[model samples]
Target: MTALSEYERLEAEGIWRPDPEAQRQEVILSLGDATLVIADDRSATALAHWSLPAMIRLNPGARPAIYAPSAEPGEELEIADETMIAAIEKVHAMIEARRPHPGRLRGALIGGGVLLLGAVVLFWLPGALVDHAARIAPQAKRVEIGRKLLTEFTKMTGQPCHSPAGDKALAALAERLPGQQVIEVLPEALDGARLLPGGLAIVGRNTIAGPDTPEVVAGFLIAAQRGAAGERPLHRMLDWLGPAAALRLLTTGDLPDDGIAEYAQELVQHPPERPNNDTLLHAFREAGVSSTPYAYALDPTGESVLGLIEADPFKGQPAPHPVLEDAQWVALQDICSAH
Candidate 1:
């Protein structure tokens, strides 16, 4: 776009030192995005970016605007007036406020003519889109797409599984995991757990076989399944896809190839919204798993997990399953850290 002003040129003069410790400069003013990043000029090479939003002012006298590189949160110096500073601060505030509120697909899009509008798109070209995707995307492509989406985040299998011990334990529990459920308990699932468009249930390493017992893992699984029941897996997928992309998928049954990367990554890095307790409890009951075990697994003293136990679906009886052989349990524990 526009040419840089003389002052702007001076502001951009400083470089983001990669080394944070080497320079040892305290951050004066930090704000914006998701991280609180500081700037260092000397050890420009040693700086590491944080997830919280932050701003750093090199010259206290002149409040210069700083921009960090997309790949690195290293800082750059620049001059700015009150107007610029206020604008930047406002943007920072807005993004921070929105960060905690996650996106969901239910009532957010379920009103009046939304579903009708989506249905109309289907009539325009019946089977055309699905057929096209089928032609281009064979089983291999679908598997790849599924894998890409799956690996994007650290998913919890709701089993607290870690090593092959985790896998074997889950395998034993899997016999009882709702017959319709397709659960995947990874040793190091990045995201907690989520249901996908298909019947795929993503899980994290800390889920079923983490440090907790099978009870906690089963609790989360029940919660995820309940969430899926309230909202279709396709709806959850569409919710994460955003409005424009959802419409495109409804119209053509094909998602932009590149969009999958970020979507998958979000699965591991971000936590999904939890369904209401009523709905979560309903699913837990359907799964025939106890709430006490999961509740205790969630929090021993019941401070944090008190609500979950109080909301237990079945206070009746524990499901039947074999404990893994001690050796197998050890294997599952090491699964997440394998790579």
Candidate 2:
């Protein structure tokens, strides 16, 4: 095995802090493609090693594990058959593409592995990573992120529907949405709507205030939920940000200040390629909103959404009551829009 020159360089530069009182320090090993580096950081020795394509770290208290690219499917090593670690491995494979240089690649992979460990501790281990995130994420920051996203969603569709009617309609619909969910109607989004992690959804006020009724807005909400349930808004978010930021969200529960802008832009520009109809159907039925409204909103040509309405999930069922009261709707309608 060749010496990992890159790792050696980083160590020489004091990038690899060897904590003798900490635990073990095995020379880093790499996966076959050299996309990731695995280190046994449980020991205290400093015998530096080269990189490999795949490796595992075994700490006495930690779960025995393997960190392979997601491409290496199936259980590499059965670590109590934990699903979260499996999910993490799969995600790693999905994101760990071949880097240009072995050295930098080694650095990124190892760094990612450490971050991965952090995420596992933060999210998958046992406690509530989502709740932790909520607590950690400032209300002011969340609201700010929400406002900027509203601005971007508006800019993308070129539909300035800041009219009172549109605002009123959005208020009515917002009242009916889930309390845990973050719902906002922008004056844009002519083409599509999006749901994000942390209980947030964005749509064009036009989507809500178009010829369609409040039921349609409700249907779109269901569809967004369906999309989120299938792949988790968090996964979609992490996918957009790449794994590094995803890892940060998992641990710290907050992204960089600019991360929200990047996420909002991606949400506006990139709609979900395929939202599962079956899931959407269930969501619609559960929400008591007819699928027709949402279907038409997706495509007014009646070609795409027409079928959804025709084969309505609840048929004559009415959607549940609003998340906000009539007055709350009015208040939200004017929320920051006056400026």
Candidate 3:
């Protein structure tokens, strides 16, 4: 492995006890491509060779780590050297990377054939084809689709709000979400939040402007994440366009610009689908944000979103962390204003 090349023939002094009954002895630990060679310090005689792939860290994240061969539990190696421990961890990661992923090959084979056939079957069996395509399409393609959709979406909603301070605040807010997905704020035309294809999320200007606390914005972001988890954006897109367009996307990696533009126009006018209250509450809990603000924002009367408020994750307690700083929230509120 290329990762091993950097530490070729690297050796270190380590205390290796042969067994539970034996006293610890200083051993010369030599790094090998596939094995760790332990030798007697004085005589330079080989003691034991541990397979790199089979080595397991016993005391993970400890100062002085312990390791043993996965198969041979009777023997143990204690290592106090940080460099040696880091090397072993790196080698383990490299070996794991080489192992075959269970369904990757099968998915690739199926994905290759599905595109053309999926397009034809889309007219008669839209749901199945869309689900299959959404499952099979690679992450890169999903990102591409999301970007294209955003471009089209911008046509109807206007350009995303961007000021130097606002951009920084937006980025900080995005970091709170899983994967640090891009969160774009639209000046108008959006009712609330929508998760785009890939990990992108879009929110309306009103969502930020209407609420006094950043918790509401954070709650909406978590709700968008919950909605995206419930339904993949690619599946939604394919359902909107049908088989022929999906086939074109599968084969050529693009959809008609006109179709995307039209869809964007329709999407701007409609609010994104809301996830069930339970799912949203779970999301809010995970993000350490209260659902009360979002609940009241959805309905000032608090009648429709009573469930969210009643089952609020951080109800009657302080949040684990503030969603945004006071300054950041102020910057975010004036995102559309010129710097």
Candidate 4:
């Protein structure tokens, strides 16, 4: 369903052959809730609707891929557009992944029987379920959950800060961190950076305000990445919501809106988690950023963060890459000014 939402209202043109003997004809194809609709080009009338889950692709890797409703003899559709082909493949993959796998169920049943023999099953089942759900969740589902949580977060923190120049600067910063999707700056309500589901990272205005260098901001980003890698955001949510919620998510690729809203409130009230010194140092070193600025910002006297200061990666030498140019840094600093 999340995959459908991502590719909703997508339409493309393709050549359709009604049968083996018929000539190919142009048709407009559109994606439905759970079907692929073929429409007549001129009249815009539906010609055929194929169940997406039941659709079959004939050509595995050839261009201008051919498809039929199923293995049965039927009309064939030939599509050459890469976007449409990718969309269909993605939707089918999501559907296939959601189906119950006999092998997996059999393994689980065997494991359950073994656990039943033990006295500590109750204490262990919940954690096992949460871990299983987190491990199996697809990237698309994680993105959907993150987007929903961000919407709820906005109710308390207000919309994310945005300015033309600031947005460009943020994009440039994101480019430095491989696999990072988006960096959101909240004008208020956040103390520092927190990683959401997917690759989203949220930070507070304090991260960029008052004598803060781009290195400090980069440090926060690195810390967020490390935290997310250590514990997946989905795992955190499932642990908070309990076993029933995790089971529901496994069956249906969604969580209750009310539960997510409650979690958002809880997140806004607490300080974001921090990674250990070793993890933080590793991230900073890999990113080619100095940790001294961020360490000093955490503790002005540098008493508590002495490790970070003493072990700064680029302490005496210059950074291999600049976090941001002077102009971009100026724009990033003023991201929350209008808000």
The candidate that wins on TM-score is 4
What is the Cα-based TM-score of model 2? 0.46
Q: Per-residue lDDT for 69-128 in model 1, tens only? A: 334544453435464455445545765676754344355556536777777675643344
TM-score ranking of the models: 4, 3, 1, 2
Native-referenced Cα lDDT, model 4: 0.85
User: Between candidates 1 and 3, which one is better according to TM-score?
Assistant: 3
TM-score of each: 0.47, 0.46, 0.61, 0.63
Model 4: CA > 4 A from native: 1-121
Q: Across residues 123-222, which tens digit of lDDT does each residue of candidate 3 receive?
A: 5566666677777888898888888889888877788999889989999999876754788998867878877788788888988887999988887777
Q: Listing every candidate in turn, what is its Cα RMSD in Å to the true structure after a full C-alpha superposition?
A: 27.8, 24.5, 25.8, 28.9
lDDT of 2 by residue, 1-339 (tens): 212322322121111222324433233333223333334444534333323334342322356453322343331321333443343354345445643578987999999999999999766743344444434555565655555555555556543435455456554565566532555555544444676555567665554334325565566666666664466565555555555565576566556657767776677666676466776776666666677766766777878665577778665665455434556444444543643
Clashes of each: 74, 23, 0, 0
User: Top lDDT: which candidate number?
Assistant: 4
Better of 2 and 3 by TM-score: 3
Candidate 1 lDDT (Cα, 0 to 1): 0.52
- lDDT: worst 10-residue window of model 1: 1-10
Which is superior by lDDT, 1 or 4?
4
Cα lDDT of all candidates, in order?
Answer: 0.52, 0.52, 0.82, 0.85
Model 3 regions more than 4 Å off: 1-125
